[model samples]
Target: MKRPKPTRRKRQNLCADKGYDYPDVRQLLRDWGYTAHIKSRGEEQSERKQIPGYRARRWVVERTHSWLNRFRRLLIRWEKKVEN
Candidate 1:
């Protein structure tokens, strides 16, 4: 039996909350070659809040969801055939 190879992650950044800012967690992220974006305790809110322009990225996600919702089959799969 041939085992399937694991798929590599394309994005290298690891975004997390302050809870993951521990030293061990940071070391783990470094070992995996991921750039950690974890927030530290008492750290002020990022520039995303101060600068409104930075929030434009969120629209991309919202727009994609809206576009997908336009497809009735994607919203609710009514096709009986698995390949349909």
Candidate 2:
């Protein structure tokens, strides 16, 4: 099967952690037309202190995972039937 073409946007953002904060990774992301939002190591804490209401992109995914974890059935996939 042929690969589907990705939809292009005027400003596409890529949220990543400090591990991806490298010149090569940044350049690759730029080449692929993504605006990288990867924070450098130890940079987040300082920014949090300076900015009153700053929140990183990854936190949203973490928060959602935390919320889902509260539901044992959903997290563990207790239901075998798809209809359930």
Largest lDDT belongs to which candidate? 2
Among these predictions, the greatest TM-score belongs to 2
Q: TM-scores across all candidates?
A: 0.41, 0.48
Q: What is candidate 1's CA lDDT for residue 13?
A: 76
Q: Write the per-residue lDDT of candidate 1 for residues 5-76, one digit (tens) a residue.
A: 322454377789987889999998777667789888656456557866654568889989888887856546
User: Which regions of candidate 1 are displaced past 4 Å?
Assistant: 1-11, 45-84
Error in Å for residue 76 of model 1: 30
For model 1, the local distance difference test gives 0.73
Residue-wise lDDT of candidate 2 within 25-77, one digit each (tens)? 99988878778999888887987999977777898899999887779666467
Report residue 4 deviation for candidate 2 (angstroms). Answer: 10
The CA lDDT of each predicted structure is 0.73, 0.80
